[model samples]
Target: MIQGPCFQILLLLGVVAVAAADRRPSFSYSAPRASSEESGPAQYNFNWAVNDDSSENDFGHQETRDNDNTKGSYSVQLPDGRLQTVTYYVDGDSGYIADVKYVGEARYPDSDEVRSYTPPRRQYN
Candidate 1:
């Protein structure tokens, strides 16, 4: 019974708001699938994300020491395909990848962790 231009505009606004709220981007990752038939640690590439590419989730990680204001901290993926949060310190002028550790398990990966390889041994010269 409420038919008016104002009602239409309000309905449109409500729809837009709902759409925006539903479009939340996920910061979590997918863990790689590993087969038990294999041996040793399965290789799972990390989804490394720089500070610029991180979401609000990174700010609330427990590894932050409850300090959500950490400036040098970043999110990355580990070899186990685990999504990790890495912290870095500025070395001179440029920033480099520092300490990398597993923060948690990733929710996605390009490949599974079923296969892992080692480099050939070489004698030191």
Candidate 2:
């Protein structure tokens, strides 16, 4: 039978071994919850990343939702080093609309004019 210092050392080792055996690395993660009647309407979101090392034709895209409308915006680098952004949105039965803008000290084409030009109908002789 062990006694004194030897007994104490053995007891300490046994306790340490038991504690180490009970220890293990653990990981936990929670996934997103699904939308249900109790949880209300569903949500939508999207994001994309572009490589900056690519050529001028490279572009970036992003999308988001608000109420009944979903909008998407795209950004691209033009040959003249100016950044161009185009955004569009779609809602219920209202259809889709888009707009373009130039982001730089100087804009291209200077200005833009939209005219509602309608051609006249011709009568048969």
Candidate 3:
């Protein structure tokens, strides 16, 4: 593995780009929320990275409640080989979700660091 100067520069730039993009996450759910807490439906983004067993495929099983929403329960894979689940709910333009529950290799969800879930930050539960 050659750590050339040019390669290092490119790597740095790539890291910067990824960081910026991650900071600005867009809702990938069907029933996306609007800014209007009174008229528009609530919006949210929840995802977890499943690094269990370091599988080549990154994916997670999740159920997105909101029978009226376009889609429900989607298995999504992140950039890395990690699995995660994201769901959404509308509470009068104020949506709610259980956070990106990562199904670890144990084949179950973890309860640690459950407080990370927030309106903007993608929390895990």
Candidate 4:
């Protein structure tokens, strides 16, 4: 009949928010229990391919060949989260052309290590 102090601080924050929502803690939605010796084995093998006309301004290529090697890549997505690939490999019998690098934040020399296309360290003291 006579309260003030913002009505006793909003009635002591509504009785401490209804006694903290009656000691809040209630959840039930179970559906995760698997076994079979802990069902392991099966993380991820390997397989690659994604060159079907990438969109979003065209920049998303991916390839992976095997038979000694022959890879190709081209990724882009750097608004900050960091990622900007541009790989290239082809060492099928010393035809070692390389690219997938971050070898110290970028720096290409040693004539960029070519093979069948030349420059397999023709000279470099």
- The number of clashing residue pairs in each candidate reads 12, 0, 5, 0
Best by lDDT: 2
Which RMSD values do the candidates have, in order? 24.2, 18.4, 23.6, 16.4
RMSD of 2: 18.4
Compared with the true structure, what per-residue lDDT tens digits does model 2 show for residues 15-89? Answer: 999999999999989998776646545468888856545333557899988777889999887756677899999
- Model 1 lDDT at residue 100: 69
Give Cα-based local distance difference scores for all models.
Answer: 0.52, 0.76, 0.52, 0.56
lDDT tens string, model 1, 1-125? 77899899999999999999999787977888787685753323233333323222222222221122223555644545466656665434454547767756665534553355343454555
> After superposition, which runs of candidate 1 have C-alpha atoms over 4 Å from their true positions?
1-71, 76-81, 93-97, 105-125
Candidate number that wins on TM-score, 1 or 2: 2
> What TM-scores do the predictions have?
0.22, 0.42, 0.24, 0.24
Which runs in model 4 stand beyond 4 Å of their true positions? 1-59, 80-83, 92-125
After the best TM-score superposition of candidate 2, give how far the Cα of residue 110 lies from its true spot, in angstroms: 20
Instruction: Give the Å error, residue 34, model 3.
Output: 24
- Model 4, span 18-65: residue lDDT tens: 998899688999897776575443332244444322322224666666
Decoy 1 TM-score against native: 0.22
- Candidate closer to the true structure by lDDT (higher is better), 3 or 4: 4
Where model 3 places Cα greater than 4 Å from the true spot, the runs are 1-71, 96-98, 105-125
Candidate 3, residues 1-125: lDDT per residue as tens digits?
Answer: 75899889999999999999889766765876577555545344444545344334544544443433423344555543245665544444455543455454433234663455333344357
